[model samples]
Target: MRSYRAQGPLPGFYHYYPGVPAVVGVRVEERVNFCPAVWNTGLSADPPLFGVSISPKRFTHGLLLKARRFSASFHPFGQKDLVHWLGSHSGREVDKGQAPHFLGHTGVPILEGAYAAYELELLEVHTFGDHDLFVGRVVAVWEEEGLLDEKGRPKPGLALLYYGKGLYGRPAEETFAP
Candidate 1:
């Protein structure tokens, strides 16, 4: 067996861990919203579980506590600019709907023209340190039909990936390999 070493936490490891392809949007109550989160991940396949981590300091955290629902929208390469835009701004300062949005299956606002999306209902939340881990069950999923190939798989051209603080990159070609 080969020896491996675990490095100490870096200043921005969170940004470098393969950025998720979905824009996580949630409505807490009334008009309060949160800056979109990128720390999302797939947790299970059997029951179709997913989750995103929200720091306690974030406005989305309190929203998640009360509303318990959110929508994750996947954007194609064409919407990288919007992804960066949403990631850069905080919802506490502006009504996200004023930006550019569409009504999704769940009636929550989704970034208009997203490649695909899923509306989820929060099932449980786990608090860890400064962040809360929210696990959710997907209630509905929709995507643009033409984007898929003859085999019914998403054909990739450009997609957004994030790396620590203000850095964004496209996924490597092989990154989408089946």
Candidate 2:
């Protein structure tokens, strides 16, 4: 096993990964809700799986515990402001459902204007140190009609990437080079 420590110049720190666009939605009783999440990834192709990490303290976390179904919506670059608004605010104090949202297959609320969205059923839950890892099976997926390119592939707009220290970012034009 490899040992790890958080001290010294080469401390055991994970470099920041580029943020991917995602919106995590869950239903708590009759209320369907969702929040913007940056920590989401595709787990597998065979089982068609995906996963998102949610802090235990988030309102969506409680909702996820109650409802086994959720949706992950990907916003286009144009929706960056909306994603930021949703991420910065708390669901407990705001009613996101009141905003523009559409009902997906699982009855989960999905923002209608997103670039694309996927409905998922919870397959398993793993408790991590400060967040819960939600593994889900993709049940359905759809994309905006005009958002696809000539090859019928999704042409996603700019993505809103997250930086750890309360800062969000978009792609930098000339920062990194191959």
Candidate 3:
């Protein structure tokens, strides 16, 4: 492969995050909204904080900022189509809850297909370049019952890993390695 210097603000740079799980961002305001996000990760364990990077231009950003509470659904295998659909559309245009999504106890929309999810109350919104990083304290966490092993560590191969340019898949595993 040939090498070239990276340029400014290129979407191609996002492709570097291969195998990052797709995440669904949910917020409720005048209308409930769900947006697919790959730019999210956990920040703390003791305080149970999670951070999601979102552009101010996104419809969900305003709702998240206004409500100061949001939920995140981590996509598992077989749910990429829904993630793609959510990422492609703006919540300002349509009701995403019309799809097969349910509300958590906090009334945040939770996709039925989530492998793991967290309901969080906003702690901070800090600016970073073009996007704002939302930090929240996880108030609740949900997971598919069989997703964990006897020791509580997640078994490999069940996560939906996103590769940029609209592609997603699980990492290859040695079938015999287990």
RMSD (Cα, Å) of candidate 3? 2.5
What is the C-alpha lDDT profile of model 1 across 1-178, one tens digit per residue? 6554656654445725657556777765455343556777878877878888888877667777777788777777667677777767777765665657766676666666666677788999998766788999988877777876666446655456666577767665564446
Ranking of all predicted structures according to lDDT, beginning with the best and ending with the worst: 3, 2, 1
Candidate 2 colliding pairs: none
Give the top-scoring candidate (TM-score).
Answer: 3
The TM-score of candidate 2 is: 0.82
TM-score per candidate, in order? 0.80, 0.82, 0.87
Give per-residue lDDT, candidate 2, residue 133. 88
Scored by CA lDDT, what does every candidate get?
A: 0.70, 0.77, 0.78
List candidate 3 stretches off by more than 4 Å.
1-7, 151-154, 175-178
lDDT of 1: 0.70
Model 1 misplacement above 4 A: 1-9, 14-16, 29-34, 150-153, 173-178
lDDT for each residue of candidate 2 in 1-178, tens digit (9 for 90 to 100): 7767756455422266557657887777678677877778999998899999899889988898788889998776677677777888888999876767877877887887776788999999998777788999999987776876665445533455666444666665443337
lDDT of 3 by residue, 14-131 (tens): 6467755535556555476787777888899998999888999999888888888888887667777888787788888888867687777887777887767888889999999998
Point out the higher-scoring one by lDDT: 1 or 3.
3
Collision count of model 2: 0
- What's the candidate order when arranged by decreasing TM-score? 3, 2, 1
Q: Residue 59 deviation, candidate 3, in Å?
A: 0.5
